[model samples]
Target: MYVLGLGGSNHGFSACLLKDGHLESMIADERITRKKYGVGLGMRLAQGFSRNYCLDMEGICLEEVDKIVGNDLLVPTMYFRLQDKIQLINHHLAHAYSAYYPSGMDECAIIVMDGVGSKRKAGEEYEYESMTLYYAKNGKFDVIKKQYGYNLPGTDYVENSLGIFYAMITDIIGFGEHEEGKTMGLAPYGDKEFYEKIRKYIRYDNHANIEFNSSDIQEMLQLKEDVQAIKNQEEKERICQKIAWAGQQILEEIYVDIARYLQEETQCKNLCIAGGVALNSVANYKIHKKGFYDNIFITPASGDDGTAIGAAYYGYYH
Candidate 1:
């Protein structure tokens, strides 16, 4: 079977062609065009494809793929016309399956917490819309559960994403988003004062859903902004440390609560975690050390890029 997996992402558009469960060809849009993320190249390539020349998947072909995937799917502009032969896995499910399938675990708990995914509403123009999760066992995959938290009204589920929350704080503290690992390293230098402040913003319920009060975060941001008035470098570093500590603490608490609840509900010792949040290696280490599960497996490409693999795996296995 020839299965083609495609991913639309802000970082870059990617396509993978799988032949009978093995990756045949994988390429990113940037490599061929010499552009960073293949921005605005989708339509350009689509026009190019009309000429009937064999174009490499990297250059303008991204735009062709995007068109095939649909503009509404948040695919990058470069992937407008490429066809995806395999079953398309929703962004979250792609993350979940990529984490679970490779582990070779028969029965394991799966958690996929990402910034955002496709949103649908029941009884609307479409029959149904939902954020879905799947469970695989004995070579069978089934929709075990779904989450609707992202659809809650009046929430900045995309831009001010929880994943970006950690990333933004990392940037404000003089670290790059790619350098978030530094914030994890610095966590040992801080105390729990900021952690106490962050507790006021998030509340965990019996269902393991984390309720975030926006006003609390706004208030804290205001306080931190004021602290930036401090002229001394040492004082500035101290303020950044406090903010980082708060973010780290909140992530730990929320994940622990979810992990505990999933363990109780599923009674599974092995846990597979994915999504942009999974990139927080420190939080990951904490989850492991806390013994939330006897074993933890994280997808190496835990971000949206892994969705390509997830979609292909779901297509083949299902």
Candidate 2:
């Protein structure tokens, strides 16, 4: 059986081909198109297939694949040409499948957390979820819980997001977009008092829900402005490092708490993690050291790039 999986329409357009349950070829559209995240590389995805695998998208040749799966159902048809051949999979489900299927564990608790994903429920018009929990056994997965960014009672915007919070801190420290690792590296040089002050704003309950009000984000924004007022470059650098440290500390706290809560609730010794946040090696180590789970597996491509692999696996398994 030939199954082609596609992930695009948001960021990181990619394609993964699986032949009889084994990976044949996988390529991210960004690598070929030289587009950083492949944001709108939709119909052009076939170009990636043609370049990487010597395949073409012309009529009659496209039927070689028995099935095609894709992530993000709402991709614009104008940009995606394979609408008839593609089956849609939930964004977080793709993340979860990517982590758990390759862990080589028969049963494990899987966690998929990112900046944002498809809505919490289908066709509900609700805010997107930030994380999802699943239990995998016998090659089947079951969702245990889902957590989303806080949406005001009557509004469509989500104001509270740990992922965005971390990204904000990364930007405030002078790193460009997606340069969060630099902020993590600078955390050790900061003071504990700064972390204490920041912790008051970010809150997460035992249910794995993260809540932050406008006050929390507003205070951080003010600090971004305050850092610029310092006359000495050294002083500005010091303050930025402190902010990075405090933000990393908060991120680690929230991650560990969520892991602990999952372990307690699922009682599974094997754990799998994915998403952009899973790329935080410092926090991953902290979770491993906490010893909440005996075995913890994290996919190497934990970010959006791996969603293509997940889409393929979901199609193959189903």
* Cα lDDT over the full model 2: 0.76
Where does candidate 2 stray beyond 4 Å?
39-61, 73-79, 120-125, 150-157, 229-231
lDDT of 2 by residue, 270-315 (tens): 9999888998999999999999999999998888878878888889
Q: Report clashes for each candidate as comma-separated counts.
A: 17, 1
| Every candidate's CA RMSD | 5.5, 3.6
| Model 1 lDDT, residue 230, Cα | 77
Residues forming the 10-long window of minimal summed lDDT in candidate 2: 50-59
Across 134-214, the per-residue lDDT of candidate 1 in tens digits comes to 555665556555554333334333332455456555765777535666776776677777776656655656565555444
Task: Estimate the lDDT of model 1.
Answer: 0.59
